[model samples]
Each structure stands twice: as C-alpha cells, then as structure tokens.
Target: MDQGTQLLLILVVLLVLFLLAVIVFVLFSVFMKRKNSLLREQIETEKRYERAIAETQIEIREETLRNISWELHDNIGQLLTLAKIKAQNIEGGEEMIEVAETIGTGLNELRALSKSINPEAINGQSLIYSLEQEVNRFNRLKYLSADYELLGDAVTIDSKVEIVLFRIVQEFMANTMKHSRASKLEVKVQFKADALEITALDDGVGFDSENLFEKGIGLSNIDKRAELIGADAKISSIPGAGTQLKLIYPLE
Candidate 1:
C-alpha cells in the first residue's frame, strides 16, 4: 500500500477505538445510575414495610393489654378478693387460720399484679391520669425510682392519648427494670403552645439504639404511636450511659 493509504487506515482504526472507549464509558455510567436508583427504591420500600409491621404490632399490643387488664379484673382480681373475704370470715380452727394466711399471701401478689395490669385504681385513675399520675405509677413500681417534673399547667389529655402514653412509658420502664437494671428513672412533660413534649431518662445499662430500631418492639411502638399522633419520637442510648425517649405531640 502507499504511505498515504497506510496513514488513512491508521486514522480509521484510531477513530473506531475512540468510539469503542466512549461507548464503554457511557454504558458504565448508565449502569451505575440504575444501580443507585434501585438501591434508593429498596431503602424506601424497606421503610414502608417496617412502618406497616410496626402498626400491626401496635394493634396487637392494644388487644393483648386490654385482655390482660380484663382478665385481672374479672377473674384474678375478683377471685383473690373473694378468697380473702372468705378467709377472714372463717370460724375458729387451725385450718381456717392457715387458709387465712394463704389468702393473705395470695392477695398481696394479686394486688401487685393488678396494679401493673390495671393501675387505674392504685393510680386513682387511668395509668396516665395526668403527667403527674404517670410519674407516680413509675415511682410506685418496684426497683424503679422515677423523679418527674412537669413544667407547665396541668392539661387534660384524651383517654386514648393517656392510654398509649401510659403504655409506652410502662414498656420503657419494664425494659429498664428487666434489662437495663436501672435504679433511677426521670420523666418530664412540657406542654408547648402547639405541642406536648415528654422525655424519659434512665440511669441504667443502655444498648445500641440503631440495632433496637429494628428489633425493639417497645421502641417501635413508641415510634408508631408518635406517628399516629402527628408527633415525633426520638430515642438515644448507649451501652453504659443509659437511654432517653423523647415524645412530642400536638396540643389541639
């Protein structure tokens, strides 16, 4: 071939190579873009699924807690109280004295269980009568010392809100007693103009909150309740410094 022909052939080959490189680069960019989009969509979908599951769990809790309360009231509570009355009425006999002692022990346990299940009585109202009432229930609980401060006028909260808040606080306090092994529980409620804020702080063993976000049923319900109430929930905890649960809700 002539030299000019050779040069033209080389130029054609170089153009084809350049085009091939650009094609590969464009394909790579498009692939990366698609991959990122897919990842984002997956994350969003996971969040939606988590929220749905949390709602279902909340419903289940409501049912279970209600049943427990009724069972304690109708069956366990009434039975124990009746037995105590019968024991006190027994005529002179060693057997009657032993029966009375048994009744006394049983009554004490029943009282404790009933308080935990349906504290509305010992609490003088529903577990969440006011912010103060909730704090009192917490203080009365064994192995948990709660010091609560209400920094605003006592506002009347709806019964539904009172129940949910009561349960949420109850669950957190239970966790503290069972797992956290904490001694001091601090609760605070502030009624803002447009919102109500509640905080529960414990000096106990905390855990990785990120991990709890996935498996902690109590925390999940707290979050779900906050969402249902058009509010916001936040929890922060480390392994040693203890945990804090913050709930904010609207006033009206």
Candidate 2:
C-alpha cells in the first residue's frame, strides 16, 4: 500500500474507535440516570408504606381503648348508679348513716373515675349527636365553656376516626378552659363530598401559637389521627387569636 493510503486507513479506524467510545459513554449515562430514578421511586414507596403501617397500628390501639371504655361506661357505670340509689334510700342509726355517707362518697368517686376513662368522656348516643352532650356537663365548670355547631348529619365513621376527632375536640376544649380568657367558644363540623372539616374556635386569651408551641403531643396526635385516614390536618394559631385546626378526611 502507498504511504498516503496507509495513513488514511489508520485515520478511519481511529474515527470508528472514537465513535464506539462515545456510544458506550452515552449508554452508561442513561443506565445510571435510570437506576437513580428507580432508586428514588423505591425510597418514596417505602416511606409511604411505613406511614400507612404506623397509621393502621394507631387505629387499632384507639379501637381497643374505645371498646374497653364503652364496657366501663355502660356495664360498670350502670351498676354504680344503681348502688348509689340503693345507698341513698337506706335508713339506719348514726353509724348506719355514716356508713351511708361513705357509700355515697364511693358512688361519687366511681362516677368521677368513670368520666375519666369513659370513651369520649361522654358517650356518643348516636352518629347524629355532636360532643355537645359530653361538653354540656362541663358547662357547670368554672373557667370553662364548651359550645357546638352543626352543618350536616354527623354520621358514623371508622371508630378510630371518631375517637381521633373526639380527642382533638377534647384537647381543644381543655386548652381553652385552661389557657383562654375569652369566654366565647365555637365548635362546628362541616362535611364535604370527600372530606370533613372541624372548627374549634375559642375567643380565649390566645397565645402566640406561631412561636409558642411547635408540635405538642396534642396536635401531633390530631395530625397522626388524620393521617390514619389518609387525611390532611392544618393548624393555624396566633397570640391573642384562638387556634384553628382544620381536618380534611374522605367521607368513606
């Protein structure tokens, strides 16, 4: 072969090698990008699954607590009421009267203890009733006022959801009575096509929630509760302005 031809042949071979190198590099980049993307997707899926499991466990615990509370309120509470009546009617001498007084004290203690553990602190007569019945009893309490409003029928929900909603309201009412100076309080629930919104507004001496508390168990529990049902919860508060918690949950 002539010298010029030989040089030309080598140039062509070098060009082919460079093109092959470029092709390999491109394929490698694509493979890496795809692998990274899949890994990210896998991480997200795992996080979602973890959250779901936690929510499910929380719900189970709430149901167990509720069932026990119901048994205490219904069966045990009724027996205490009957005993109280019987003791009140009993007649006897001074010692007997003293014994009756002791019995009366025991009955009162039983009732109070029942209130503490009884689910809802006041049982839900039906899905139609709000926590108002339970809150009413607290009305007589000084430095505390519980108010309620309605927009639609408060139907039955998953027992866990009900307890969460109930506890959120309970905590709010307690906070108001303990910290709020404003007497006016509002509790209302509005149901949308796919979600339920609950508003608990108190005109109490509102604290600077913006800076005061970040994530307390009370609020965290509420959020965790909403999360269980795949719902979203938002809390807005300001000093001298009451706290507002909006929970959005699907109807089903």
Candidate 3:
C-alpha cells in the first residue's frame, strides 16, 4: 500500500477507537445514574413504610387508651358512684359516712384519670395543659410528689407530635411509679427557637443504663417512637441515684 493510504487508514482506526471509548463512557455514566436513582428510591420507600407503620401503631394505641378511659369514666365510675350514694343513704352510721367520703375521693381521682387518658382531651389541649392535668392528678392521688414545669413561651405544636410526646412521658412516669419507687417526679418542657426539649426525672432507685435493653424498661420503644417523630432521646441512670430522660424535637 502507498504511505499516504497507510497513514489515512491508521488515522481512521484511531478515530473509531476514540468513538468507541466515548460510547462506553457515556453508557457507564447513564447506568450509574439509573442505579443510584433506584437505590435512593428504595431507601425512601423503606423510610416511608416504616413511618406509616409507626403512625398506625400510634393510632391503635391511642384508640385503646381512649377505650380504657371511657370504661373508667362510664363503667367503673358509675359503680363507684352508686356505692357512694348507697353509703350516703345509710341511716346515721358514722362508718358509712366515712366510707361515703372515701368513695367520693376515689370518684374524683377516677375522673381525673379518665381525662388524662382520654385521647380527645390530649389532642385538643396544649401540651402544657395536658401535662399540668397529669401532674395535678399524680399529686392529688399522692402517687408521688410529681411536678411539671414549662420554660419559655409556649408555641403551637402539631397534635400528632403532642400525643407521641405525651405518651412517652406517661410511659416514663408509669415506669417510675411502678419500678423506680421514686419519691419525686419532675417533668419540664422548654420551647426554643429551633427545638422543643423535654426532661423527666425521678428521684428513685436507678439502674445501670448501659444494660437498658436487658432491663426491658421500654427504652428502645421510647427511642424508636422518638425517632419516628424526628426527635432525639437520651436516658441516663445511676444505680441508687435516679433516672432521667431528655428528648429534643426540632420545630419547623
């Protein structure tokens, strides 16, 4: 072959090779982009599924609580009322009068409990108000010296978040009452510019926080619920000292 023709052939082969290289690079880029999109979508779908499940669980729990509150207010409450009425009617018996008064006190506590457990009440009122009712009930019943405080100006909160937060606090308080054998319980809510912070502390005998899962104190459940609502939860305890739970939730 002539030198000119040979040179032209070499240049054409080089150009073809370059074109093939460009095609491969473009194809790889497209594939990678598609793969990344799918991966992101899968992650998002999983997150959404988890959130839906959490919400459903919350709804079911609230419904159950409401039912219990209704039963307390209607059934057991009626029975107590009837007993008190019968006691009051008993003729000139000092013991019967004392029994009547005791029954009245029991009725009062039951009413307060029903209100506190009622989902409708919690959903309708501010977090501070709900917390106040809970604290007042605890004090009235002498469940322990319990107190609730609010710091900073109150801001409007979503009802869903309110219910979840309230449930978390209720769970902690119940645990404290049942297991902590604490003499005092304090709960505080602080509204900040960017976040809402909640603290619940009990002066009860504490346990090893490092073995929280082993203790089965519902800490994991609390953490999971907090995560679903975009909140951070921190719990600490020192044996023979006390246990404290702090939760921070970002505000939009």
Ranking by TM-score: 3, 1, 2
Candidate 3: what lDDT?
0.90
The regions of model 3 sitting more than 4 angstroms off are: 92-94, 213-220
- How would you encode candidate 1's per-residue C-alpha lDDT over 1-252 as one tens digit per residue? 999999999999999999999999999999999999999999999888876775676567666765777787678877877887887797958888888878777666655555555634433454334445545655655567888777776577766566667667666766776778788989887777877788889989888888895645356667767665457778889989999988887788
| Better-scoring candidate (lDDT), 1 or 3 | 3
Write one digit per residue (lDDT tens) for candidate 2, span 1-252. 999999999999999999999999999999999999999999999989987896677657656766776676678767766775676577756765676676666555555545544556534433225366546645645346667777875556766566666666666676666666767677787876667777777775566554445534245466666666677777677776776767666787
Each prediction's RMSD to truth = 8.9, 6.3, 2.0
lDDT: which candidate is best?
3
- Checking candidate 1 for backbone clashes, the offending pairs are none
Query: In model 2, how large is the Cα lDDT of residue 125?
Result: 38
Instruction: Pick the winner on TM-score between candidates 1 and 2.
Output: 1
Model 3 CA lDDT for position 148: 85
Taken over the whole model, the C-alpha lDDT of each candidate is: 0.73, 0.66, 0.90
Q: For candidate 3, write residues 172-191 as lDDT tens digits.
A: 88788888989999999999
The TM-score between candidate 3 and the true structure equals: 0.91
Model 3, C-alpha of 26: deviation from truth (Å): 1.4
lDDT of 1 at 247: 81
